[model samples]
Target chain A: MILTVTLNTALDVTYRVDRLRPHGSNRVRAKAERAGGKGVNVARVLRALGREAVVTGFAGGTAGAALRRELAEAGLPERLLPIAGETRRTVAVVDESAGDTTLLLEPGPTVPAEDWERMLHHLGRLLPGAAAVVLSGSLPPGVPEDAYGRLVRLAHDHGVPAVVDADGAALRAALAAGPDLVKPNADELAAATGLADPAAAAAALLDGGAAAVVASLGPDGLIASTPQGSWRARPPRPLAGNPTGAGDAAVAALTLGLVDATPWPQRLAEAVALSAAAVRAPLAGDFDPDVHRRLRPLVDVRPLHPPRSA
Target chain B: MILTVTLNTALDVTYRVDRLRPHGSNRVRAKAERAGGKGVNVARVLRALGREAVVTGFAGGTAGAALRRELAEAGLPERLLPIAGETRRTVAVVDESAGDTTLLLEPGPTVPAEDWERMLHHLGRLLPGAAAVVLSGSLPPGVPEDAYGRLVRLAHDHGVPAVVDADGAALRAALAAGPDLVKPNADELAAATGLADPAAAAAALLDGGAAAVVASLGPDGLIASTPQGSWRARPPRPLAGNPTGAGDAAVAALTLGLVDATPWPQRLAEAVALSAAAVRAPLAGDFDPDVHRRLRPLVDVRPLHPPRSA
Candidate 1:
């Protein structure tokens, strides 16, 4: 079973309006809500792929209860540690006429030091039977900066592969713990390594002890570098829809491949196909099975030579 | 004890940002949430005035639970009836730089016919000991359009005074039920009667069997017409601040006066003073006691002559 960790969970709310008028009253035409956070999304995708996945994290207050309820209704297993502060809500105001979305993100509640320790204790119990562990999303306030690094070490101590899907300093810190894989989108890779070239930035993370690095290049697809070799994969054509959960889909595919010891090229191809399928789905943490099946065989994975200097 | 009914309750969320840009992401600098709706505001203000207020309405789902939790934390007594649909949320995006607010309102969950009956049954029990019953806000979907009219009748059956704070058909219907009082702002009165003159519109409701009509005139203060006499009251000067809950505060003061059987001029003066104080407060359902005390003595209430034609 795959174990997914979302330190900062959210109740995602989407409001649809005819148009968003600044400083004006808007009557929302419709609304939809779901439990969300990067690892939660990954777990959802993993479940869709017929894989057993368990979610663990810190959740508190009314919003946290709501999130847990939604997860239960969705049949996603969760073991959330309780805290004093309520979990955050992330709202997306979708303009139906303009086809645009404006986001209002609440900085999640602060988790006390004891809460973090308790979460670690809970996570330690789950790691024993996990095929692979995913440490994803931003660290909430009061959680140490090296939380992902510490989690990576915990997974490794249990002889389980860990995948770190994070950005900036957290990503930088996790690399030294030698996570089995790290997935950073184009912007995140640049932000973490300060390298304009995706390959160079990915290479930097690989050198910092990540066994492999897969960089999502948005519509352009993904570039992955592993100890065995390097490869780039892309969907047959660019697909446009909600891209919110595409990265999480890729992470799910990558983790699945790591558990099965799939070849790097095959794993890269699967990640690209699954991500494109996620983009076609209307909401995050969901994908069209038909679309995934059709695109899987068509994904093009090609070998890429390392930079001459490297 | 005062009884306030909020047929469509809400979780009022306020997000403060540097500025509001339509169709653009906003990083909220601060957030505050509370249980709110027209009658809920009235109940909160009544509590602030040292009156015991009991709130009852339909509440269900996650949002409803959150609203109940907030009300509990605030020490507000509630007898919310259960429903299947989740409660709605009204978001106010406050632009600190522009000094303006953008509102996004969800049309609340639908109430089943059985739910309405259950609520009426519950309200019937509370009316016996109630000093007054306030039917406030718009009726949610599935509720009969003449809901307030029925509620007014219920109150009168128990020999309790009823106040209706509503608009359009609901206000028109309640007038025929002979509610003890009806409060409509200038716009609502005009919309309900299709008359531009506030006095003429108010007279129409009085003619329709309402015992009294009080029209809120925004910065101009309040004009009240009752069988006893007609009066107009204004604060020393127009107070400018958040006007979100000013009318509810006015309703609270008017309800208090009705229970105490205060004279028309004194009641109107109290309403005007309390409303101005509410405007100075940071949030709805709250007022500055100091401001209320200062404005109360200075409010001017004077006899008003009927329109020449009327």
Candidate 2:
């Protein structure tokens, strides 16, 4: 079973309104809610792909309880540590007419040092049996800056491959721990390495100690780099829908490939296909199975020249 | 003890932001939440005034549980009956720079007929020891249109006074049931009676068998009509602040006066002072005690002419 860690778990709420007018009352036409965080989303996608996945995170207060209940109802396994502060909620106000979404994200609760320590201790016990450990999402306040790095080291100590999906400093620090894989989207890639070129940024993460780097290039598809080789993968055509969970679907594919020891080209192709399918799904943490099946054989993965020196 | 009924309770959530732009993401600067409904606000204000107030209504689902927990934390007495549908949440997005609020009111979960009957039976047991019953707020879907009228009859059957703070058909129906008092703001008064004149519209309710009619005239204060006499009351000057709960505060005072059998002029004066103080308070269901104390002695209460037609 693969283990996924979301340091800052959230109760994701979506409100659908006929039209969203700023500074005016909006009567929501419908609402939907689910448990969400990057790793949680990855774990859900993994389960959908017929893989065993367990989610672990800090959950507390009423919102946390609600999140846990929803996860259980969805049949997603979770081992959440209790905390004093309430969990944060992320609200997406969807404009039905325009089909646009406006988001309001609350900064997660401040976790105490003791709580972080306890989580680390708990994670140590679970790392040994995990096929791979996926560390994802933003670090909540009060957590050390090198949290992802520490988790990567712990996973490596247990002979478990660690996959880090993060941005900025967290991504930078995790790279230093030599995580087996690091997935950064285009915006996050530039933000972390100050490189305008996705291939160059992915190569930089590899040189910084990550065994492999996968960079999501939005509608342009994905670029990946490793010490042995490099490749670029994209769907036959861009699929348009909610892109919120596409990256998580890619991470799920990458982790499954790591467990199977698949070839780099095949892994990149599968990641692109799954991501395209996820984009077509209405909500995050879910992918259209039919779309995935149809797109899997059509994804184009080809070798790329190593980036020229920075 | 006073019993306040909030047929449609809510978890009132406030999000403070720097500015509000339509169809744009908003980063909330701060957030606050509390249990709220017209009668719930009345019960809270009554408790602040050192009166015994017990709240009862339908509560269910995760939101309802959170609302109950919050009420318990605040030490407000409640005995809400369980229902299948979750309680609604009302979000107020307050733009700090503009000092304006945009409201998003969720249509509450539909109530089944059996749930309404169960609540009525539960309320019957609590009414015997209650000094008065206060029916307030909108009736959730599936409840009968004459819900408040039925409650007023129930209170009279037990020889207890009943106050109805509602609007439109519910107010009209309750007035016909001979509730001891009915409070309607200017807009609600006009909607219920089809008359723009507050005094004349209030007298129409009296003619419909209500013992008294109190009309909240916003910044202009309150005008009250009773079979014995008529009176007008206003604060020394309009209190400028959030007016969200001002009308509920007035209802609290009116209910309190009914329990004490206070004179009409004194009741009107107290209602005006409390309502103004409530306006100065930042949150609903709370009043500025200092403002209430200062305004109470200065409130202007005087005789008024009876309506010409009704």
Candidate 3:
């Protein structure tokens, strides 16, 4: 089973209304809720692709219990640690008439030191049995800035590869631990490296200590920079839909590729295909199976040469 | 204890943000969640006024569980019946910069026939020991349109008076069962009786079988039409903060007056004062006790005579 960790997990709630009236009451036509955070979403994608995945993180109060219940209902496995503070919720209010969405994101709870230490111990045991462990998302307040970095070292101790999907402080901190892989979206790549060009940003991450880096460029597809070689993969055509969880879909495919020892080209192709499929689907962590199947072979992969002794 | 029934309860969630950008993601600075519905709000007001108030209603799923937990924390006793469908949530996004709020109200779960039947049995067992039962709010789908009516009849069976805080079909239907009292805001009163005038609307509700009708007219205070006589109560001056639960505050005061057999003028004065005090508070179920006390006796109450056989 692939183990995933989400330190700041959330209850993702969607409210569909006929129209959103600013400063006025809106009657929601429909609503939905689910467990979410980068790692949890990655686990959900892995499960959808027929891979066994288990999630571990901090959950507390009513929202935390509700998150656990939803994960159980969705058939996603979790062994979340209980905390004193309530888990946060992210509300997406969709305006049907305007065809736009407004989001309200709550700052998640602060994890106590004891809870963080307990999590490392929990993951230390689970990592040995898992093929790969994913460390993702932002650190809740009260946790060390290098929270993911510590998890990476723990994975290495268990001889398990760590797939780090985070940005800013968490990403930079984890890079120092020499993670097996790191996935960042366009904005995250730029933020982490302070570079305008994607390739430059990707190269800087490698210099900083990551073994490999995969940057998701949304509709432009993904770029993989590794010691073996660098490659850019693009979907045959742009797909129109929600792009919220597209990166997680790519991460799931890439993690599977690591486990199966697939070639970088083939892995990048799979990542691009699955990501496009996720975009075409409405909710995050869900993809159109048929789209993924049909688009896999058509993905365009090409090698990128390093700068000639600049 | 005064028993307040909220047929369609909600988890009232409030999110505070520095500014609201419609169609864009906003990070919430703070958030809070509590048990709320018209009846729940009324019960909270009663409790704050040093009255022993207990709440009863259908609570199901995570939101319902959260509601019950909050009620316990508030020290309000409850005997809620569980149902299959999840209770709804109401999100109030407060924009601090704009100084306004945007509400997203979920259409609560449809209470199945079996669950509602079980609720009736639950309430019947508790009604006999209650001084009065307050049936408030809209009926969840799958419950009868005359849900409040059934509860009013049940209260009568126990020799207990019934107070209704409802509008539209629920209010109109309950009046036919001869509830001891009914409270409606200006819009609800207009909708229930098709009368533009507050006094006329209150009279219509009384004629429909309610023993008394109290209409909350916002800053204008309240108007009461009872079998004894008619009177209009006005606050000394307008007070403003948040008017969301002003009517529920009024209902809380009126119900207490009924239990104590207070005179109409005094009851109207109390209702007007409490309602205005609620308007001076931020949340729906809270009021400034100082404001209430200062405004109570200062409320101007005057009797109104019916048109002479016109």
Candidate 4:
């Protein structure tokens, strides 16, 4: 079974409005909420794909309880640790008329040093039974800057591969700890390496000690730099829908590829297909199965630079 | 002790942003949340004023639990009935640069028929110990339109004065049940009675069967029409701050007057003063006590008409 970590779990809420009016009272026409964070989204996709995945993270207060209850309802197994502060909420106000969304993201709870220590101890225990460990999302305030790096090292100590899905400093710091794989979206890739080209940015991460780097470019598809080879994969047709969970879907596919020791070309193809399928779903952490099945076969994978030796 | 009812309770959340962008992501700099509904706000003020107030109404789901916890934390006694549906949330996004707020109000949980029956039974038990029963705010979907009216009738049956603070159809329906007093802001009065003039609009409500009507006129102050007489009350000077809970503060002061059998002029003066004090406070359920005390004696209450006997 694989393990997914969400250090900054959130109660993701969505509100539908006729047309958003700034500085005015808006009566939400419809509302929806679920437990979310990048790792949680990856775990959701993993479970939906028939892989066993356990969610581990810090949850607390009423919003945390709500998050836990939702995880139970969704049947996503959890090993969440409780804390004193409440979980944060990310609200997406969808404007029906304009067909756009405005987001308000609350800064989640601050983690105490002792709580971080407890989390490290807890991860050590769980690492033994996991096939691979995936660390994802932002670090709440008060957490050490090299949190992912620390977690990556711990997973290694247990002889389990660690996949880091993060951005900015969190993504950069994890490289030295040498995660088996790191996934970053297009913008995050640029932000992390200060490089304009996806391939260059990914190579920089590889040079920094990551075994492989997969960068998701919405609609454009997935580009990967790995030890075995380099490849670019794309779906035959662009799917138009929410792109919120596309990156997580790719991470789930690529992680499965790592566990199964799939070839680089097949792994990149599957990642692109799954990412495209997720875009076809209305909400994050969900995908249209038929879209996945249809797109997977049609995904076009080509050698970007061939094997490093070649 | 006053019994305050908030059938549609809410987790009122506020987010402070540097500036609001209509179709962009906003990182909230600061956040604050409290249990709120018009009735809840009234109860908060009543408690702050050292009045004994017990809150009773329907609350459910996690948000309901949150509301209950806050009420407990604040030490306000409650007899809230539990339900199955989740409570709603109201988000206020404050734009620091714009110096304005945008509100997103969720349609609270829908009440089942059995819950309404259960509430009447619950209120029946509490009325005997109550000096006055205050029914405030909107009725959730599936609740009877005449919910406040039915509540008023129940309070009257137990020889308890019922004060209603609502607007539109809810206010209109409650009037015919003959509540002792109804509080409506100027816009609510216009919406309910279709009269532009504040005093005239209030009179229209009295004709619809209310024993008295109090209309809040924002910074202009308040106007009251009751059995004894009519009067217009104003603060010595206009004060600045959030006006979200001004009306609730007024209702708190007026309900206390009813319990104490204060004269009409003194009651109106106190209501105006308290409302202004609430405007000075940042949150709705709080008031600036110093402001309240300083402004009370200076409130100018001019008789709109001589006592009916005179």
- For residues B174-228, write the lDDT of model 2, one tens digit per residue: 8878999999999998998898888888888888889989999987899998877
Task: List, in order, the clash count of every candidate structure.
Answer: 0, 1, 0, 0
For model 4, residues B1-310, the per-residue Cα lDDT tens digits are: 9999999989898999999999999999999888899899999999998889998888999889988898999999999999999989899999999999999999989899999999999889999999999999888998989899898999999999999999888887898899999999988989898889888788778879999899999999999988788899999999989999999999999999999999988999999999999999989999999999999999999989776663
2 versus 3: better TM-score goes to: 3
Model 4, residue A206: C-alpha shift (Å): 1.1
Model 4 Cα shift for residue A79 (angstroms): 1.5
* Cα DockQ of the candidate 1 complex: 0.77
lDDT of each: 0.91, 0.91, 0.92, 0.92
Question: Clashes in model 1: which pairs?
Answer: none
User: Which pairs clash inside model 3?
Assistant: none
Over 4 Å off, model 4: none
Instruction: Compose the digit string of candidate 1's lDDT tens values, residues A248-293.
Output: 9999999999999998888988999999999999889999888899
**TM-score against truth, every candidate:** 0.96, 0.95, 0.96, 0.97
**Deviation of model 2 at B243, angstroms:** 1.0
- Tens digits of per-residue lDDT for model 4, A1-310: 9999999999999999999989999999999889999989999999999999999999999889989999999999999999999999999999999988999999989999999999999999999999999999999998999999999999999999999999888988899999999999899999988999999999888999999999998898989998788888989978889999999999999999999999989999999989998999988899999999988999999888868863
lDDT, residue B196, candidate 2: 87
Per-residue accuracy of model 3 over A30-134 as CA lDDT, tens digit each: 888889898888999999999999998899987899899999999999989899998999999999999889999999998888988898888877888899988
lDDT of 3: 0.92
DockQ scores of the candidates: 0.77, 0.64, 0.87, 0.89
Docking class of 3: high
Which residue segments of model 3 deviate by more than 4 Å?
A: A306-310, B306-310
Task: Give interface RMSD, every candidate, in order.
Answer: 1.1, 1.7, 0.8, 0.6
